[model samples]
Target chain A: MLKPLGDRILVKVDEEKEQTVGGIVLANNAKEKPQTGEVVAIGTGERTPDGKDIPMTIKKGDKVIYDKYAGSEVKYDGQDYLVMHEKDVMAIVE
Target chain B: MLKPLGDRILVKVDEEKEQTVGGIVLANNAKEKPQTGEVVAIGTGERTPDGKDIPMTIKKGDKVIYDKYAGSEVKYDGQDYLVMHEKDVMAIVE
Candidate 1:
């Protein structure tokens, strides 16, 4: 039930098994691995310089790929979610 | 004569003496030290989601303070300048 603001979106990060190699733990935060998430909520879109509201392209329930280091991590009701701007999202999974 | 694009602005970085202490030099790229520059050229402003162009707040010859690590370095006429988005600018010095 988290609501984002200003072109930001609330996302539920998909969980995946950690990758390891030869008894070495690979870093999970590398830039090469883009994260996927399900959009839970969206903001009211970004405002134009003239104070006009711009509509958002991505909608709730859409799957999206985002930048590795995008968004702020927020814990809501014992669950973790990310609140990031729309620009951080690279593409929609369709 | 480099013009920025999409809410980006070109800046002429002000030259200052590098700080040195006890034969040790402090890293010039620290976040605490915000950089100041004069606005040179700016892009046509960022486009709204509906394809409308937003007007820029900063103007040419304005002295502005920007984030330490903001923008890309470029050389024009053998002088160093930064090309960065307007959001990277913290404030305009009056």
Candidate 2:
């Protein structure tokens, strides 16, 4: 259970299934596609110049979409996760 | 003289001289190097979550160094300019 700092978020990346066409799996060499994940943990939030907290838009268990190149990858307890700023999240999957 | 928007600063790029060695100029294809510029105009500032102003660190007439891929390029009055957020500026050259 890693606690994120500031406006950072810890996300558990969802396992993406390999794409297959005609029963042949396509190799994904370019990882530029967007990724989806579940919010595992969230930081307190960003602070204003006056030090007031800015409320986070995403919460725990929320399914979010983020850019491929955004965030740093971390492995904790044999699990792979991404730690990124809240701004890296593009949208919440309904 | 284009005015920048919130947190954005307008900068006039300093012309970089071609690298010459032994009276031969070397062509530079990779533009990943940082660049220097003179600040021209700036936005009022960014707003806090509660709408308070976050004062800008850089001001007009300041010479600054910024990331190579930081901003949008603009052409104004036959002059090239870059409009980027103040955060894009790495430092001010004294």
Candidate 3:
């Protein structure tokens, strides 16, 4: 199992959409990188200057939107995951 | 003054560096867009599903690293500023 440390999270990115709003077939080169993903794992929390733990509001299985260039990309067991700090997550899709 | 709305923030990006760590002069086209900036203005907070406001931890004048494509770019009085969600800011440069 891959466990993240220090407020880091692992995200499984969603599949890319091949068509645009106008139904144009965008080539792979023209497709904008996706920013949405499903949370896989997360750390407990981040430590503050006072040595207090700031608990993360995000949890596993949440659908999230993250920053475009936020995380370090890694492939584990043939699956792609983005490992990034909790701060990079934009919002939770409820 | 430009005021941000609903967890949005305005950031002033730092100047671009012309040289690399290896002392190579990088041209404008070769330079990667920077992710670090100083906070300028910020919204009060984001409302929760229950209608509670979640105050932001980021304040004006803070130096932060944000997602590369996270914000909308705007020029205010000859200065370049990025308008992005607080979530797009990855970390505060303390």
Candidate 4:
């Protein structure tokens, strides 16, 4: 288990679901990779100039959509993860 | 003047500063493109599921560092700009 530090998050990307139209199966690569993910771990919080903690809005296990190009890729234990600042998250999916 | 909508911001990217060691000049491309920028325009806020607004943390004229891979590039008035979510801004440069 990886623990992130300070305003960072570990995201497990959601795979694009298969879609078919008129009985024709679409190639998996044809669809853009979904920017959605499940948050696994989060950092404590960002610090203000005065050293106060700026509370993070997103929480662990929150399903989130993020900027398509945000974050860095990390491979661990044969799995891939994206570590991003909480701000890279664009929206919380309903 | 483009007014961003909904928690988005326009950033003017900071150029990579030149570096020298022992009077040897380094190629500009040898250095990574800086992730810092000056905020220009900002969106009002992102809305909560219940229609409440989540005010933006980053403001116009603030110098911020963002994820290198974040944001989309646009050329406006012959100048380059990046449009990104406020969250993508990792830190404010003091």
**Among these predicted structures, which one has the highest TM-score?**
3
Q: Write the per-residue lDDT of candidate 1 for residues B5-90, one digit (tens) a residue.
A: 55778899998777889979888764468889999887667767676679999999999999889976655568878777888999
lDDT of 3 by residue, A1-94 (tens): 5555558787999987676658878666654564899998886577454435589889999999997888876555688777798899988999
- lDDT, candidate 2, A6-40, per-residue tens: 57788999998988999999998675589999998
Q: Could you give the fnat of all candidates in order? A: 0.06, 0.06, 0.00, 0.00
Write one digit per residue (lDDT tens) for candidate 3, span B53-84.
66676789988766567799999899999999
**Candidate 2 per-residue C-alpha lDDT over B1-94 given as tens digits, one digit per residue, 9 for 90 to 100:** 5989888999999998888999999889574456778999999888878787776767899887666677999999999999999766644555
| Model 3 pairs in collision | none
Q: Count the backbone clashes (under 3 Å) in each candidate.
A: 0, 0, 0, 1
Q: List iRMS for all predictions.
A: 10.8, 11.4, 9.9, 10.1
Candidate 2 stretches with Cα past 4 Å from truth are A1-47, A51-94, B29-31
Q: DockQ each candidate and list the results.
A: 0.05, 0.04, 0.02, 0.03
| TM-score of predicted structure 4 | 0.49
Q: Which one is best on DockQ?
A: 1
How high is the DockQ of candidate 1?
Answer: 0.05
Give the TM-scores of the predictions, in the order they appear: 0.48, 0.50, 0.51, 0.49
Q: Any runs in candidate 3 off by more than 4 Å, and if so which? A: A1-70, A73-83, A86-94, B20-25, B28-34
Docking quality tier of candidate 2? Answer: incorrect
Ranking by DockQ: 1, 2, 4, 3
Off by over 4 Å in 1: A20-32, B1-94
